[model samples]
Target: MVIINVLKIVNWFRVTNSADLRKYDFSEELTQMKVMKLLYYVQGLYLKLYDERAFDNDILAWRWGPAIQEVHDKYIGQREIVGEISEQDLADFKEVNSDERLAEIVEAVNEAMGNMSASDLVRKTHEERPWKETEQSDVIADDLIKDFFDKNFKVSRE
Candidate 1:
């Protein structure tokens, strides 16, 4: 349920940000690959800043990059651009929208990474310590991501 909720929030972002992303050439046709990497960065940065993971799902080192199995399966052949979230769930998870710091992190990642092609995103994730250390299909530990981002980015956990 937590993963579903997080997926909803992330997918909602993909949908809502399509217009603004156009200038960066990351229009509405966001690929599954791009979405997954964006989610991974969001999780990593959120963990770095807040000392907590944004989602409960394990981020696995899939062939391409970090991915959530359930979310991956849901969008295997999806071309809908964005996944749906119930109004009640959206209302209940106000923090996904209202947390100003989290919003900034999400926007920064989306803006920075959104225009990348799927292959480029895959390569970028592969360079990440968590993904590199993990074997294919293995879970990328949240602590690893947190430690890497904290050390490399010097992001204050304020």
Candidate 2:
């Protein structure tokens, strides 16, 4: 179960990280800090609407804000995001693409949060409940994220 879960996260990281980099035209300016924070927002919004996590990995409360340790490690020491979306990763998102609502949610998240600077995103997530309730380096709970988005964003919990 654990290994299966880890592989799911790995594929999600490949798809999302690649999408983000492509959105930014693969600029050297895109850093790990920006990618991690954008991922938190995407995950939070997905949880709000779907009542489940967007990615399979744990998002830990880091000094900056919510950070996916796996994604962080993948881009460690890289100035710009560098990765290839595997055939499996493509297939996974292809499944996701069949769900129009999920596709819109992802597009909305990227459009809204993609342009923000890394520092701005960090500050915003710092004020959000999931990160605020977690101790440094602790995993931010899914329930906290769902509750925050549901209450604050007016997303229906039913």
Which candidate gets the maximum TM-score versus the true structure? 1
Estimate, for each residue in 1-158, the C-alpha lDDT of model 1 and write its tens digit: 13335666565565555544555563556767777888898889888887887777789998889998867787777744544545654553455656666667777777677667768988988888999999999999889999988887754334
Which residue pairs overlap in candidate 2's backbone? none
Assess each prediction's global lDDT (C-alpha) against the native.
0.73, 0.70
Model 2 residue 151 lDDT score: 84
Query: Relative to the unseen true structure, what is the C-alpha lDDT of residue 48 in candidate 1, on a scale of 0 to 100?
Result: 89
Q: What tens digits encode model 2's per-residue C-alpha lDDT throughout 1-158?
A: 11123334334444766666667675334467777776777678878887776668889999999898888777678755535667877776666556565556656766677677788889999888899899999988988988888888744322
Indicate the worst ten consecutive residues by lDDT in candidate 1.
Answer: 1-10
**Cα lDDT for residue 44, candidate 1:** 91
Report the Cα lDDT for candidate 1. 0.73
Per-prediction TM-score: 0.78, 0.72
Candidate 2 local distance difference test against the native: 0.70
- TM-score, candidate 1, is 0.78
